[model samples]
Target: MKVGAIVTRIIRQMVRDKRSLALLLFAPLLILTLTWLVLDQESSDLKIATIDVPDSIITTLNDQQINVIDIDKPKSALKNSEIDAIIETAGNSLRITIDDSEPTNSQAIMMKIQQALVSKANVQQVEINHLYGLELSTTFDYVGPVLIGYFAFFFVFLVGGISFLREKSQGTMERLFATPIKSWEIVAGYIIGFGLFAIIQSFIVVLFAVYALGVPLEGSFWNVVLITLLLALAALTLGTLLSTFAKNEFQMMQFIPVVVVPQAFFSGLFNLENAPLWVEWIGNFMPMYYGAEALKEIMIKGNSIDAVVLEIAALIGFSLVFFVLNLGTLAGYRK
Candidate 1:
């Protein structure tokens, strides 16, 4: 009878939390639906540019379901990522230059090209070159930058949101409201206080990823750190803003499925190139997408900060917007 009474009380408590109940029932289904949308879509066509290649080779490539486009500047197209590869005749041999920024796409292009050549009689010698990756680069090398950005974002978001929520739940926010502090000042103080630790965390994560894990640092180390710090700030501001809506830590955690999980899917970790237009559109709104893209540009492609200015700008923009929203949310507590 005692155990039954305790169980009944716990059940009543759970039923009273409508948000938690809804999250428990619907979060998994939402994630599964997103997974299906990403994984079930047809892959985008593989486009290869051919310059002065034989008609037989082009026809073979087409037969193998690769799109072959005739172009005069195969090098430019490959560099611009306009095409996956460039195939051209170099004397008696055919030279294939692949954009190795994305190893999966490069591997796919290589497989299709080899299959096409093998099916044709008297296959010419093929010379392969990578645009960015080394011959020894692994899948980790391709994904490490994205992982760095993701971890930085994830930890900062989780810590900042929970910390801010704790302050509210503990009545610290109520005490502050009794002071002369403006709502924006409170938001600014929280960002600066949390941001110091976020900066430290970003540096630690980048250093470990590059040195301990042997992730290649093709670009300047500071560039990687800069992107990670910006991403962290974005996460910090976003977390504090969202925390205003959450009544407690449990509700803060509920934001994970709704906020963080979708960013993981939309971030460069998964290839959304072949997904529906709407799916890619959803990625546009995600700050992590820009963060991951900038990290890749610096780490993988060895590009300068100038090359990723747009992505950096996007991250700053997200931070500013979230900071403003945090200020607005704090206004409710002022009353």
Candidate 2:
């Protein structure tokens, strides 16, 4: 009888927590729906630029669902990732130069091109060259930079949100409110306190990724660190802002499914080339997407800071917006 009462009480407690109930009931379904929306898209619509190629080859490529465009110079297109591969006639042989940053996509394009060339009896030899990534580069190498940024963002968000929630729950925030300290000052103090650790965390993760894991560092090490730090700051500010809506640590965790998971899907980890235009647009709002793009440009393409200044600006913008929101949320608590 006592055990039955205990079980009933626990069930009543769970039922009272509407957010927890909703998360349990709907989070998995939401994630699955997002996965379907992402993975259920059609195969990659690879674009290949051709120069002096026969009409038969172009026809074959089109039949394989690859877009074939004629270009006078393939170098610029390949460099910009505007086209996946460049095909041109070299005497009796064929020359194919591919952007190998995405090894999986590169391999798939090569396979399709080879299948198309198989039908051409006059084609003698096929010479393949890579524009960026090494010939031996694996899928991990392509995704490694993105993973580093994601981890840095994830940990900082989790820690910062929970820490700020602790300050509120422990009455520390109320004590601060009783003082002459401004809301913005309190927010800035918390940011500076947490941001120091975030910087250390970013450096450790980036260094480990490049040196221990052997992830290629094509650009300056400091550039990667700068991007990681900015991403962490964005995460930190966002976390503290969201914590204002949570009453406790468990409530803080509820934001993960609603906030963090969606960003992961849209953060360039998966190939969304064939997804709907709106699906791609969702990524533009995600800070991690810009961070991933910048990291890939520097780490894979060896591009300098000037090339990724726009992405850096986007990260800074996200941080500033979140910082302002934090200040606004704190206003309600001010005495």
Q: Taking the tens digit of each residue's C-alpha lDDT, what string does model 1 give over 1-335?
A: 33343335434543675654333333333433344344332224878998788898898899988999766687887888888898888998888999999766887777778878977768854455568745323456666788788777877788778777877999988986887667776677667766766667677777767776666688999999999999989998999999999999999999999999889898887888899999899888999999999998888889999999999999999999999888887886678
**Weakest lDDT window of 10 consecutive positions for candidate 1:** 24-33
Clashes of each: 0, 0
Instruction: List candidate 1 segments past 4 Å from native.
Output: 1-123
Please report the TM-score between candidate 2 and the true structure.
Answer: 0.65
Residue 213's C-alpha lDDT in candidate 2?
64
What are the Cα lDDT values of the candidates?
A: 0.78, 0.78
For model 2, which pairs clash?
Answer: none
Question: Given candidate 2, what's the lDDT at residue 258?
Answer: 91
lDDT of 2 by residue, 1-335 (tens): 33343335434543675664344333433433344344333336788998888888899889877888766667898999888899888987778999999666787787788867766677765554568746323455667788778777877788778867887999988886786667777667667766666667677777777776666789999999999999989998999999999999999999998988888787778989999999999999999999999999998889999999999999999999999989988896673
TM-score of each: 0.65, 0.65
**After superposition, which runs of candidate 2 have C-alpha atoms over 4 Å from their true positions?**
1-123
